[model samples]
Target chain A: MADPGPDDALFVNEVRGGDQKAFEAFYRRHEAVVYRTALALVRDEMTAEEVVTDTFLRAHAARERLDPARSPVPWLQRIAVNLSLNHLRRRRLGIEALPEVAAWPDEAATVPEAAAERRETTAALARGIERLPAQMRAVVVLRFVHDASLAEIAETLECPVGTVKSRLHNALRLLRDDLRRDFETAQPGTQPLAAPDLGEMGESIG
Target chain B: MTGWPDLARFILGRRAGGDPADECAIHRPRLAELVDERALGGTQADDAATTAALDHLWACAECQHEIADLLLVVAGLQRLGGTVNRLEPPPGGWRRLSRRLAAPRPRGALRLRVAGLVVVPILAALLVAPALVRDLGTSAAGAVDAATRDAATVAVPVAVTHAAALQRAFDIGDGAQADPAAQAVEVVPRGPLPDGIEPDGSAFLPGVAVPPMPAVIPQ
Candidate 1:
């Protein structure tokens, strides 16, 4: 994670000093990112909500231990990610059910044909992202989704930068191949069908 | 915009006609390397190595397509944050956290709470079980005694006139055993059971069966 901004740092210090308003302000600033990051990993709304609750609750409980110099985003994000992963493990959901194909809504400005193609591509990408393993998905979300740098992701995940790179490479490689397979074999006009054996992709990527 | 569209068009265009099997084998990993660097917004590849990889990427149409596809994928991934934030927990979700914070926290509160849960149920069962069991036993005994009495007192042969009635009354076959005469004794009710009569059946006597009665309707 990047360093916390001066105002955010100040809030952390204030929260350590028992300022409820400062904590609330800090929450308001970072909650959306934390929630979005959790939803990306867990992909369930209610579980993600619980993750948000737990993440902030933990941050508040350990307020004195939080360093004002560090960006609280990574700290909060790591908690949400861990909790979301644990939720998935407890469910033994093994692999998630892929999202249903998104409809290509008609828009006035763009050509229907182009819009449909883009929509299909977007849906495929979304599904591919969803299919990544929990840890790989976390790396992808931090790197690609939130635009975290390699060093920042390493700091957040508490892994080596090389590990983050390998995971990202493996994740993108599988996602690209999966999406490519879908596009190649898809019925030309309809939504892409769910392919079987995502486990096979995981092995090949690994 | 120029490189972006050109990249998209060439990628989405027809694959270059050839035996892709061998060429794909060689370039796929290299393209993966370039794309990984590009995806991370930087390349660990030094300038010379970077230049050589880009040269090979431009020269190979398959590599171009792979790089193009990955770049598009990166764009889509970058958009995910915005798209996903659409599902952000609705405003004031913090109210739950705020409520939790406002609640008092004593050390070991969680352990105390869990222990309370386990202990309370066991304690309750200990306190309440005997009375509950006694009440239930008395009600069951009274029902059986009343049913057996009603079955025996009817003047008609129970199997003939009241098989259904007896079954309904005693939940058995005709309320008759093989030696019905020996088991049953005719009890003449001195009168209709007196109103407000309550049976205290706590006292047990051998060879004297006291018909269990219903609770008194207190006057």
Candidate 2:
């Protein structure tokens, strides 16, 4: 017989029945995405863990009404992303901004086939991604990190797609320039233009 | 006179449906124009031109929304674009999926199809692994951050493989148990989301039938 409810829905129902065990089970099942979203947004390990704990707490408190038919990841993400952004805003007001951390998770160990130059390029891009403004960082995370669609990102951020587009493009362009400089610095052999060439001078005179 | 931005916007059109790849190539000339021939010919970046173009790109809000396809290819943006925001999940023994499967599939309106497909199998894999101690079909060298990996390894449980065991841990964990100092914290004053109106899921789950997930989704 086909069970109409999926695993997530079953977990949701179990939690709704006031089973704390099921709730813990629910956290176990979904914590990865929720924590990943938070880490991507906040770029700090400690804060991301805190967000995960808080998200589950809120989920537990609201367990009575969670829709058992749906996957709970989105709800968890909304809460996590919201909390992560709040921390960023709060930190900005009370303290000097921390040196930008890469929005990308470190891949030195994950990418086995990465060549020397590929690793260098990714490092430069990661630095650029970290340096992007917080809001722009959010757009990039939602798009690249979570793989959310443009409209999905807009809905999550409570903004228009145009705004998301602007942020993403600006973010990419900045990364491009940052990567360009990385190459420029890496390529020590290339010489700078020193003097006007006679060929250029004759052409200009003509 | 129509400015560069106005012209670009007219050409790029509005991609509210989220298919932005078609317009990706249009912005390359703009990026290429920024770097000198040396940078173009794989020699060196002209400091003055590269700086000016980057400056213009920063100042130009219009250029910000557009993608340069050539730049994406040459700068290896396509390879990094999908995983840019991804970080390692807290140690729970789940392996990161292959990068190709993990890449964002921007081809269709249903953005979740690819990602959702990637997720379902992982969930199924975990559930089926009655003894989920080892990383499945993945390399052993996954621990990227030594501090976090080493510290969390002993503190957190090895892994929670099933919903059946959701009991013992619950009594010890009701929000306040997270920290001794957090006992006074109040529950967040929020209600459940309205029925059938899930945040990212509403767009796909109800309407499109992902037949594969339904079959393997464990109870």
Expressed as tens digits, the lDDT of each residue in A1-206 for candidate 1 is: 33467687788889889899988988888888887777777766666777898899998988898888877888888888888888767756555443343211122223344455565776777778767788998898888657789988988899999999999988877887877777877865643422222222123222
Candidate 1 TM-score, true structure as reference? 0.59
Return the DockQ of model 2.
0.09
**Candidate chain B TM-scores, in order:** 0.34, 0.18
Per TM-score, the best of the predicted structures is 1
Name the top lDDT candidate.
1
CAPRI quality level assigned to candidate 2 from its DockQ score: incorrect
Q: What's the CA RMSD for each of the models?
A: 16.9, 26.1
C-alpha RMSD between model 1 and the true structure? 16.9
Query: For model 1, what is the alpha-carbon lDDT of residue B5?
Result: 73
Listed in order, the DockQ scores are 0.21, 0.09
Docking class for model 1 is: incorrect
